[model samples]
Target chain A: MNYIFHFGDMWNARGEFVEGALMTLRLSGLAMVASLVIAILGALARTSGPKPLRMLVAAYVEIIRNTPFLVQIFIIFFGLPTVGLRLDANEGALIALILNGSAYTIEIVRAGIENISQGQIEGALALGLHRLQTFRLVVLPQALRIIVPPLGSQFILLMLNSSVCSAISADELTSAALDVQGRTFRAFEAFIVAAAIYFALSLLFSTAFATIERLAFGKRISR
Target chain B: MRSFNAGDVVYLLLAARWTVLLSLIAFAGGGLVGLIIALMRVAQARAARWFAIGFIRVFQGTPLLLQLFLVFFGGDLIGVPLGAWLSVILGLSLNAGAFLGEIWRGSIQAVPNGQIEAARALGLHYGQRMLRVVAPQALRTAIPPTVGFLVNLIKSTSLAAIIGFVELTRAGQQLNNATFRPFLIFGLVASVYFVMCWPLTIAASRLERRLALAYKR
Candidate 1:
């Protein structure tokens, strides 16, 4: 048990670590926005669109949900080039994250939407709201309230999933740790530092989500 | 360079057996550990409960990739040297246990307090109450989420590839490197996973419906 722990290498590589963490944030943030958009559209399609469109969305969700994210990244990063749609590692990673994230998001949002009572939509229609207005004004706000907590957790999960992007050589935190470990041969210390940084990031994001929840739904619920 | 062939597909399909094996190991190990964790979470002792909470938090907070990396390499650094197979199983089991423990804890709590009181009035002891009354009902509630987590666990066994365990994903990488046909190779890889996981998803939903019928008012 005479293992010598070293943090000096990690300290010297702080710049790379910071850059990597920021890349993780950026990648997750961008994918978060993209996936939310896709999820909302996919959920809406599943809920009220034509039968064919709903089936299409359902199939997409099923396929994505059933497969591994690493394989999805590999397919996009490598497979897309064969069709003349070449993308860099970062772009490929972001697309994979969004594709995977949105499928779960669609299910969550659909559940939220379904949770709204039938009377609410009928009441909105009786109040002279059009179908679009009824959905926008009456249904969405309530669904968002029900959806926020799980959605926040999913976003955190997305942040963690971003680590898988390292498989394709994305310059994110996990890849940076791997690079450091290769250079310093301090795999243990390198990953420990990366794990600690990830823990901090999770805490930070959870607090931020709590604040957002308060600001977004606090007053409405309190009333 | 060789083009993709039937041999490559056979290589992948054969390699997928390792993926299935790793998943089974994770599920069995995780389920055993998770039951302990779930019980600890519900234990009256403050220390046991806090330890359970800390375990869930640490595992859930960090990436499974890092956990796998740590176990695979850290074991060597400490001279224990769990090779790729043992390391992958250990890492995936720990992660899955944390998630399953939490899911089961929720299901256990969801069981009606009235049922517990009824068991108490019948003069049942703690073990008898949990085993005969509570656990059966909690199990019904636990099945859907537990199966769902198992599906996710199967997909995650692919991560074992990073530590040089040549499962489905790693086998695909090898074939892709040699053939240089990513589309055909990776697409075949994904379909193999889909074939494996889609049945589990369907089974979970069927079980959910059966449980719903059993509980219907």
Candidate 2:
């Protein structure tokens, strides 16, 4: 306990931390949107597609879920080049995040989708809606209600998982901390600041999601 | 560049034991801490309950990588000098404790309040009420999620590589560097992780279904 706390070096390097936090938000936000799209499609395939397609989606989910994100990113960032897919670090990171996030989100979205009673879809069809329209107009909205809360948790997890992208030299918060700590040798202070930023970022997301839930659910009730 | 040969595969397999060991250490340590956190979370004392909440908030709110970095360096700052093994163990355990604590808290709370009242009416003390009546039911529900979290813990031990611990992931990285076969090496590493984790995932789901049936009774 003899070491005096010196925030001096990390304090001077606050710009790196700020830029890094912004980069993290940017990277995760992009991945969040991209993965949601993928998950929605994958869940559709899982729940309503042909037998072969369902098996394929199920296998993808199982493989991804059972493996580590770090290894998955390593495979994408490092492994793909052998197949002539030479993506830069950020592109690879985004791809990796989307792939990883969708596997989990597909399950979450699938759970939401399956929770809607079949009679509702039938009722929509009975009202002269097309099958596609029935899904979009009737099923999806109700499924979304059950889906939003878990989706929020998944997005928060995706944001935190973005820290792993730094291993591949992706320009995010953890890498930002790595740069400052490597130079300042203030590993303790450097990571503390990075972790606090992450903490704040997650808290912000949680609060925003809670507000969205309130508004969305309230609208349904009032209408 | 060397090819990813049998020796590299053997090396990776050997290194996987460290990953398993690290995971076990974290699980054991985290389990003990999680039990305490779960108890405190459900405790009547405001300070204990708040402490548990804040512990979960801080630990779960941040990424495990940063928490690893903190222990990996916070030790250096405090003159404790916990090197890679000690640091990864402590860091992963703390993070796992927060998650497992939350899971087990839900399980504990799932037990009916009337059951506790019934125990109290029967002149059962707090210890008797918890150990004899509540624990049996909570344990039935807790097993599935607890097993599920172990899969996550197993995958998470790969983070030890960042701290220079030569677990399976680091082994793969080193072999990939030597062989220039990232595809072969990391794929093998991931498959090894899959082999370890997939069975647990299956078991967890099975247990979950069985628990559901038990509750249905």
Candidate 3:
């Protein structure tokens, strides 16, 4: 088998690839932060709010979780324009990412919250800690620790799923690869390079999350 | 503007049929290949184990979207004869096999060592012990996660639309191009997918509980 060594072309395109990687990082980072906030609130509401509110939040989680993120992006980017809620492709894609990420996050956070022992809640109440304060100070911290690894994996998955934004013309890493490949007509080489870049990014983000988990939870070796 | 049409709805429903067919093909094909990989990883030979591990690592390390593009374009480059249906099925099955293999390996290991030892002491051969003693219990543990992954596989099939597969999402895109009614078209698309996936999700949870209760009893 012969190989085309196009180091010159790949070098010239390095700047474009870097720019696309930055955009991918920005998109994934913003989506992760936004979904973290939404998920906390959604999880809390689902666990403790009134019946109607709980049901509404549950519905939101189930609907988003069950549908494909690609379909959601299509709806927001392409479908929303018909309903007079037009947004540009990037905005639409970001919204869809946050919405989809939050659904999975809600489940993760709720599981964490539920893992807090009832005895701890009783201890807090007996000590006269307010309900909200107990949750904020005690239960949440422990729960977050329990949920950290899975949550990290979820964010990595989110970064990979962010490739769907390319389908809506968001011009991130995958889209940039598409453009370069079209211009060069070296589709195989372009995709191989692109897939390697994505795999590297995933490893980078996973390491970053592991560091963050260490910082947040401190080193308490349970095992 | 064209008025809302029942005919469009009928077309979307028909497209959903392809989505179901693609999911079945991927799941069945993936399951068979995954079984081989799982057994290979479980084999006493280190070379077989390492080869299966490397295969799973390469596929699992990459995203499904990239795999789809590689298969679609690589088919063109190599002069492989395949339509959208065959290409998507081949790509998704390979991806699913890697993941499901790892999942089953973990589940199989979760079965205690004593059970296998006891099976051997009872004069069972290695193959007989695995088939009669180990596999049945691992399969029970595997069912829930396997079902969850299958639901995910179904959703992932929507990516095939990018390569011109006329599944549910692609059909919605076609209708939207014609009617210029993105909201109605994609809303219908998302709902159809939700309807297809939600049952599996529920079934997975229920089976998980049942398995847990069965072992407890």
Clashing pairs for model 2 are none
**Candidate 2: regions farther than 4 A off:** A219-223
lDDT of 1 by residue, B61-81 (tens): 999999999999888988999
> Model 3: residues >4 Å from true position, as ranges?
A1-8, A211-223
Tens digits of per-residue lDDT, candidate 2, B36-121, equal 99999999999999999999999989999999999989888878889999999999999999999999999899999999999999
- What is the full ranking by lDDT, best candidate first? 2, 1, 3
Rank the candidate models, highest TM-score first: 2, 1, 3
lDDT: worst 10-residue window of model 1 chain A: A214-223
**lDDT, candidate 3, B91-196, per-residue tens:** 9999999989998998888899999889989999988998999999899899999999988999999999998899999998888888888778888899999999
After TM-score superposition, the amount by which residue A61's alpha carbon in candidate 3 deviates from its true location, in angstroms, is 0.7
What's the distance in Å from true for residue B44, model 2? 1.1
lDDT of each: 0.92, 0.92, 0.86
- Give candidate 1 misplaced runs (Cα > 4 Å): A219-223, B117-124, B213-216
Error of 1 at B188 (Å): 1.3
- Computed on C-alphas against the true complex, the DockQ of each candidate is 0.81, 0.90, 0.63
lDDT tens digits, residue span A1-223, model 1: 7799999999999998999999999999999889989999999899989999999999999999889999999999998988899799999999999999999999999999998999999999999999999988989898989888788889889999999999998999999999999999999999999988998899888888888888988853321
lDDT (Cα, tens digit) per residue for candidate 3, span A43-100: 9899989999999999999999889988899878886777678698789879999999
lDDT for A153 in candidate 3 is 83
Better of 2 and 3 by lDDT: 2
Fraction of true contacts retained by every candidate, in order, equals 0.80, 0.94, 0.66
